[model samples]
Target: MSILYVLLTTFGVIFLESFLVALGNLRFLFLLNVSLFNKINWKHLLSLSVLSSLILDVIYHYVLGTNLLMVAVPLLIMMGISLAVPLENSLPGYSVKFVCIFLYYLFVAFVPNLILTGQGTVITGVMLGGMVLKAAISVLFCVAFDIVWSRLRKKEEGTKLRSL
Candidate 1:
């Protein structure tokens, strides 16, 4: 049930992001296409987001001694919000993506620590270090997913052409 919930939440966030990007409302123009609005591959994005979220959850639990859902739910929400609210004319480059992911994890990790436990002391700088680590992980995951998705799409197109 918990895993299902996490999967659903992660997919939902990814769908929202894809929709926003398709609408040309996203701040980052990392990739451009003629059919930017119509060519979004939602399934790929959702799968990638879920996989990345799972990885992040594992890291959080092993290192921070917290449950996966506790971290994943808020992180998904933060990423969704960040995607929905685009920065001014900011092209989505590696740096922009890195910062966005980092900020999402940092906020999800730190704010709760401060608010819920009232333990604001930095634990071996884990808060800061974790953000960078997670962000890099996310970026790499996204890049790999994008590559795989593109290849699959190309293959599908080629198959259709051959059949025709």
Candidate 2:
């Protein structure tokens, strides 16, 4: 059931990102899910990341390996953070999530634009602003999910206690 949950959310992110213009190539949804939800095992998260990036690449018509490289770097960083740092529904955790999402935007949007357009390229205000907005939105969404999940867990615990 947890595997199914992970797969659904990961693929749902990929689907929205691939088809929706507003998503703007940012994988924050997936990043936040994997970072916050320890239920997703490492192996499944890794495979899903690789698969999603490839699918995004094909959908967006990028060079085959570009998305994989961009997506993998931040994913590894997030995985390390999730493992080493005890992130919960707190300020530090939220800050880390925002930073990770920002870095993901940098890698997915800025770096590729830099590489493709060469050193003479400028990142433009619109792109940077969009990244910030997306990151903020992702953080907010994570917080909301945490609240709902906590409520559900509490209700379940209460029910178990009553049964006892």
Candidate 3:
């Protein structure tokens, strides 16, 4: 259809999806069933993601250009990976998501700029070190968020059981 329309739409979705993923990343519960993470609340995630993105789109739009591809594409890929390589709690799954997210951000930092601008990349020890530093920071934030959410969830569950 319209490239401009798709551009804006995708840009908006990029913003919204990032926000939603931030919320999801903060999610600490359902840690056991990582395989069904999307399937279980896919509807809720989809609706909320759209709404948040649309609202933000109405605000100010960032000129992301082809970087917009980073929005949903990797998520779909990760979902596929999760589905194909089902990470059972009896096995291990959380770290898989962590690695995926880390790699996704790493791509966001270097890949888009290289692809869109056609500037070849120079991979150096320092650059890799910086990426690792940033990724580790993200892990810290996610773990902190998870801890808070987990405690809150447990507290709520405890109250519910008491009421029963």
Candidate 4:
């Protein structure tokens, strides 16, 4: 929940994508996991997300303007959706949050690269398959993180109750 932790996690994802060959492409899943299930304020999260995207754009030699657009569009869509559907801490709420974050990651990961490389707007079979796999992996990891964090929180609360 701390800003330091948030920034470190963002940089960790960057490091993973930049340095690790086998896990490089999993940054999307990692970022989505952090973003969807954190206690950070939306404003802080938005700013940090943009900052991370800028760092990533420079590191990847991305086109100057595309990264900002890629960051903003999905975030704005998420913001709009959040207004329509409040984010509660229940199963259906988690489902909505996951769906929004899933779409956000897909757009951020796929669309800008396509534009930057001048690839025409065509979603090929391989690309679609990759998207599905990424979604599955993201879902798996997010759920795991949720479970672990919930248990940790409960244990922490239990300790507090005993001390009282």
Candidate 5:
């Protein structure tokens, strides 16, 4: 995809999350993972991912040091994983990609915040049950995306078969 489209999609998703989820920033990590799995060159995807994160940091006005770490850490992990797995092939399937992407989103979203901002408040009695509410928005949207992507993929396959 063109860089402009990539950037627009990334920002659109980010805006959608911020508007809908009220600080839920899973979209960046989600897009980073998806773009990498598009079977494009890892270097290009990595650059775009980092650039997107940097743009986010700018928007949020995060401190220079922590902001840099926030972007760099995930990029490092992505590099490590790509090194171990063959990049020439796309991710095995959407389910596998979703799981990995979800886990990576957790790490990317929470860990750095913990490090830079310190451990958050205890999940005292009542708060413990609210975890589902916290996650439901992102998960539901992901399921919606899965439906859309799968339909698009099927259509693409049909067209390719017709062409053949």
Candidate 6:
């Protein structure tokens, strides 16, 4: 099924990235609660990812005039990464989410395109527009996912307390 493929690919990419970052001594993986991702309501994330991918596909096709898998796949990857990682308290602000999305897009989307396809361009005005759009979508989806996660987590906690 397509859902299985997406989950497999997303997890594979996340695992590989975490491994490489560990090898590189980046320690970025410490920011995440890995178990939370597996436990969190995945159906919500999956639905959002698919919707975001389709919307991005249309945008890229119509606006950029390029069928760039690089753009879309990385968006999905970001969705996974967002779910995996928790924001630090010091960085607690709305801007931090956008920053996370922007960095993810830059490193995951742009750098790979440069290395693999030999295509590199400065983040220009037009590219910034697209980046902003991507970040907006990421923030929106992240917030929605968090809302559902919090509600579900609270309900579970309440049930546990009641059982005691």
Identify the candidate with maximal lDDT.
Answer: 2
Candidate 6 Cα lDDT to native: 0.46
lDDT of 4 by residue, 1-164 (tens): 56787688677767765653256355452345344433435666666666666777787678665555665665566567667776444565556655655565566556777877766466667765666666556556666766655555554452222333
Clashing pairs in 6: none
Deviating ranges (above 4 Å) for candidate 1 = 1-92, 113-124, 154-164
Q: For model 3, how big is the CA root-mean-square deviation? A: 9.3
Whole-model lDDT per candidate = 0.46, 0.66, 0.47, 0.59, 0.50, 0.46
- The residue pairs in collision within model 5 are none
Worst 10 residues of 3 by lDDT: 26-35
Estimate, for each residue in 1-164, the C-alpha lDDT of model 1 and write its tens digit: 54675466556554554564366333121122111212345453444444544544453343332323334444454356557654222345445556655655555555546655777645457557856876676666556655555555554452222332
In terms of TM-score, which candidate is stronger, 4 or 6? Answer: 4
Q: Report the error of model 4 at residue 103, Å.
A: 2.8
lDDT of 4 at 74: 52
Please name the candidate that would achieve the greatest TM-score relative to the true structure.
2
Q: Give the range where candidate 6 is weakest over 10 consecutive residues by summed lDDT.
A: 26-35
**Tens-digit lDDT track of model 3 for 10-104:** 55555544564476432111111222244324544444344433444344242343333443555566677777676433123445555655565
RMSD of each: 11.8, 4.8, 9.3, 4.8, 6.1, 12.5
Candidate 6: stretches off by over 4 Å: 1-91, 117-119, 155-164
For 1-164, candidate 5 gives per-residue lDDT tens digits of 56776677667645764664466434444543444344445555565566656666666655444444644554455556666664332433333334444445445445556765876434444443343343344445555655555555544452222232
Clashes of 3: 0
**Pairs of colliding residues, candidate 1:** 28-92, 29-92
